[model samples]
Target chain A: MGDRAKSLRNTIVLIAGLLVFWQLMYAVIGEVAMRSPWQTMRYTVTLVETDFFWVHLTNTLQAFAVALVLSVVLGLLIGFALGLHRLSAEAMEPMLVALYSIPKITLYPIILLAFGLGMSAKIAFGAIHGIIPVALFTLNAVRSTKPILVKTGRVLKLSPPAMVRSILFPAAVPEIFTGLRVGFSLTLIGTVLGEMFAAQHGLGYLLMNAIGLYNVDVIMSVTFLLVVFAAGVNGILLAVDRRLHFRV
Target chain B: MRRVRLYQVGVIAGLLLLLEALCLAGVIDKITMPPPHRIAVDLVKLLLAGKLYPEIGKSLANVLLAFGLAYSTGIVTGTVLHGYRTARETLDPLFATYYAIPVFAFYPLFIVIFGLGDGPQVLIGFLLGVVAVIVTMLNGLDRVPRVLRKTASICRMGPFETAVHVTLPFCAPYLLTAAKLALAYAFIGVIGSEFIMARSGMGYEIGYAYTNFDNATMYPLIVLILLLSIVMNGVLTHWEKLLLARRGQR
Candidate 1:
């Protein structure tokens, strides 16, 4: 406990030092090109109180939530199908990986053409980007389940469905969680990219507006909020992963 | 082996033929989804006009420069941080924050600071690629076996020699994984930045086509970019396999 505390203290100190260094660099760069650290903070606080800020925040968050839910559903279904049947897995894996390897942004134009520039396009884009990781990871996890475990379950005369539920699903849960984490991150990236390319409103639009007006402080403030939101999302996922990653 | 390869080629060809048939049958509109032949013709025209090569060259240069900067800095910084656990812990939150903060959000700031040029594009790409590389390398360092470290020390190897001969070799797979991921991210970073604000590049061409509603041109550009990514990934994976084979021999 003492050692842990000491380590934590050292970490805090180092973080503080880095922040100071960042601020000093900003000071040296001056305010014409980039705002000072204090200026960015003040601007961030001011923006936080605005009604438009909340609306945009809600818009981005809603898109992200819908994307996340859809990805989890689709990923699990497809992953299960691929994992359960070896012949299907062998036939489909290459094509799936090929599609996955394609830079998703390349699909943006096609998606926009099909879905039009609206929430649907954003949601679909996010879902496509998010689903690949989950499907790939889950497929890998299920395929890698120990042969010994399957044999033991069969010897015990467990039913097929029971063996899967009792052995396979639990065995793959850790890897599934890893996929979930990656899927969530990709979802956020896709949503942000979608909004940036063409959107009427959201954080991406707001940032673009600030850029148009040359409002450096607002841009910096929005960037700070985005960073904080992303870190928070990652932290929550990490905590969930830790809690649910129990071995069979 | 021959049969399997032939089957794979047949499948790909069949898919292409099916797509072409759909376009010809008007099940898919040619305007929105052009046939492969049309795209091929357009690609040849663009190449002959000398427009495609320059644009591709510009984009490739930007990606390579940005990737090089990010790779060097990420590896060096990652190595140093791994040596000092205290430093790694301190930077962990910062790295997480930066990673999460869609680097795209700061495109405007970069443009403002560096102006509307390759400067900001490369900077954004480097920023995006470097963060992922650092995290991956750090994780790789942590996973280095304790036995390897003990053996190196017992052999009286100096710190620099140990790192070069033992630590780096062990982390080869992890580094390759990082390189693969970083390449993708760097591509997105550069293209996305260019899409929003740029004068010339493949991304600029696509963005121009979009504004003009020239789906024909836009579709071909997108195809080119996708092909580039596929080729790059195949090359990198092959390189990694060769490295791993050599390491295994060692």
Candidate 2:
């Protein structure tokens, strides 16, 4: 059989295996703390219908949207500025990477103090978390563009701005999209962590609030919602990436 | 490169000096940020008086242990996934998607199951870190050219022999890269769990200071965290450079 067909079959089998494992764990524990896969799935559907859940979900989404746009705009500008010059790019790359790798979540306390317990704190935290990776990736994307491509643009007597729009931007779009995916994920994590640490509303706040009440169902359901949402968004991003990442 | 290096150092020093000047002139709030000189002095005192050692030890121990666990499990899982081409294709999407999801929400669930303290802490750290290692290993192993498999058969080598002689050596550098990234994530995971709740750890100490609004202690702790991150990053860069130099020689 071809690899693709075999792989799809394997995926179905793996999903079945995961389900069995979840059920087995639930059986062994038989505790509310460890809900069955079926239970969490059912609870997830019910949670989606509630007004309270919607409010928190909206808050999380809003933070994500703001952070995503801010990070992308800032990342492109900074990345291009640095990436165009070899000296600046090499000197700054390490710092950018260090900042990106370390959990900026550690800086949350300072952010909370500065921005208060409002949505602003979450937005700032999420933006910072997302910005570094996007900027670093964009820098890399720009730096790695083919020299031949740029030479061809010059040969055609294209203006610098036109060169960027046609040659540089298109050549780097694939990597920029990779950065976007990473930024999206980090932004989600930042927003959730911010809400958990200090926020009146959001999925993270709800998760923590549920913990205080020892509401196991809510915790599992919330987690389920987060996973589904992340997977859905990632799938869309992946599709977009594949379409834009043309092989030259 | 040398000039750029000097420029970078100078820029960082200039920024620090500016911050020090502002704090010295009382331009910045003392409560929000103590002067750099004072923070340095206080940090030395905390280290000398043995106030922060136990917390550092606890956090370090958790990170190392969790990283060890992650390294082993991540390697095994990656190997298994890669061993079956179909499995590799199937699981790749799930793992990639999960790279973004907040695994922290499960901390409470872990607390309920493991009864808090170090068990849940280490487990959470392992979860956070293992993904990086697994993905690296899978990619590395996948990149081992198919020619090696053909060569192995020509030489009458068994599966074990082929893996050890061809596949393992080929991916050694990638494995090292994975180790570096895994350690970084392990520390982040360990510290994060500590921040949330821990009997003793750097993270727990930071959490304590923040809750009490103890700026005196918080600033120094943050400085310590920054130092730790810089040191880890330096080690990884040095190791990678050494590896590349050694490879160039061969």
Which candidate comes out best when scored by lDDT? 2
What DockQ does candidate 2 score?
0.59
lDDT of 2 at A186: 82
What C-alpha lDDT values do all the predictions have? 0.81, 0.83
Per-residue lDDT of model 1, residues B1-250, tens digit only: 4555565677789988998899899988855678888887887777678757888899989988888888888888898888897667767656755655677777888788778999999998899889888988999899999999999999999999999999998999778877876777778778878888799988988888887888768887888888888788777777777887886841
Compared with the true structure, what per-residue lDDT tens digits does model 1 show for residues A9-36? 7657865786687588688767866776
Residue B202 lDDT, candidate 2, scale 0-100: 85
For candidate 2 chain A, which ten residues in a row score worst on lDDT? A1-10
**Model 2 stretches with alpha carbons more than 4 Å out:** A1-14, B21-27, B146-162
Best by DockQ: 2
lDDT of 1: 0.81
Interface RMSD of each: 3.1, 1.7
- In candidate 1, stretches whose alpha carbon ends up further than 4 angstroms from where it belongs are A1-18, A87-102, A156-163, A246-248, B1-18, B95-98, B143-157, B243-250
